[model samples]
Target: MSFQDEFNSGVLEVISPSPAYYPDTSRLRITLGDPPERVRWRSKQNLDFAYLMMYSQPKAVFYDQLDDILAKPHFITTMKIAAYDRIANKQSRFVLDFCQLGFIGKMFRCVELPWLVQLFFMFYSDKPVDRLLENEIHTKVSLLATDDAACRRAKDELWVHYKPSLFQHIGTQPSLKEKLKKSGNAEHPSDRFYNTTVEVLLKIVPLSEASENMTSDGYVIIGKFDSRCIAEGVVSQKLGAFSELRLTVHSVSDNRAILSEIFIWGQEAR
Candidate 1:
């Protein structure tokens, strides 16, 4: 979809789902059936600020605080857009045509980008006329610049990017040119992407089996035992944070039996 359409729909869904309510006593109690087109245009300009933020490298601390920034009453004004345009024109397009296919191999390490831009290339292209211009411009940089310095300069002049990318490319297959038959290794994954998996390891032992001495409490038992002789089993279950795992132990006969040990190990989930 066009950026304008996407922006309008998103605003309708998120910012103004219905006519906003105001206090009866307030001076601004008047309500309109629909916001004027100019108001929508101003909102779109504010959204352009979001794109500008994503393109430019802001302080690492503010990477995850974009929502808070956008919540401000006057975050992006028309004056700021005009000021930025005066300093750095966003209208210019940098097109670099590759005449030699062999030159592509040597250009691999020429440009290093944030994970988000890398992800755009993995699943999108400029072949289709309807594709977003931003994607086309971003992917075009690698072809336009021959060295790291040139690429870095282009990025500084174009848009902002955040460090430790918020999203990762996890697909094991390519989506581009899917109509053509292709084979061989197709995995393309981002190395710098943040790891979101939360793992937890739990160990349970009978009250009698647990060490009475505080010094020896560090030791844990992790070994195998015959189920016939000793009732032992491992259950691999997914659980959420602060969830409880209850274990019930019973003896084959009426006689009392002690549950020796239970061990579970995995990274703590976040």
Candidate 2:
């Protein structure tokens, strides 16, 4: 399997012995482990455009439109429902299917929007989730990102926009509840699949500290760090020494912040 190794906030640089291994992409491919064991993966793109193109011209248009919406720092309701469905379903045979798309989208995002996008679902069946759904989904994604407390304004909005359905599902899955309690939690494929998304914002998004005093107010406050180097070092070491990492960040009244929590997302006792 291929995987991207992030170190020191910048892209992990490895010298490939052969040019064949180094494709046109900026990423470097490396083989790790004794006896020549290795993993091949790329983080440049997360969707599959080729497969998407096979659908129809309308599908392609929706795909482009959805990309526009997702490129926004926040959700765009004008996004086609079908586009959301493909992503929610992991619509690719493998990664790198959307390599070019991710490359283009990153440029658009930097120039235009900054907040993550949200798609509204119809409550029950026919009723569309209110605008509050955006807030609620944001809070939930924030919680999964492991951010808590720390934002007074967002905190207030969270309570005003709380949803009962969240609690009902929480009981059915207590472990997920526990996972939400920590920060910098290395999200699983499932976590990445569901909930709102947190794309690595800006040049790089570091793994922040985990939250300690988490609340049911629908948010997790993982701490934030200054440099990507520090973030990658912490995250890399944690994964190497442990197995998984749970990342959390706490924000003080000021825009500045500190690391409050750090949990190994997929940690297993040694």
Best by lDDT: 1
Model 1 reaches what TM-score against the true structure? Answer: 0.22
Q: Would you give me the overall lDDT of model 1?
A: 0.30
Please write out the lDDT profile of model 1 over residues 72-154, one tens digit for every residue. 23333432443345447554322221111111101111122244333333322212211232444456676888898897677
TM-score for each model: 0.22, 0.18
Clashes of each: 14, 53
Report the lDDT tens digits of candidate 2 across residue range 191-246: 21112212121222223532332334423323333332133222233212322233
- RMSD of every candidate to native, in Å, equals 21.2, 20.7
Which candidate tops TM-score? 1
Residue 185 lDDT, candidate 2, scale 0-100 = 19
Q: Give the TM-score of candidate 2.
A: 0.18
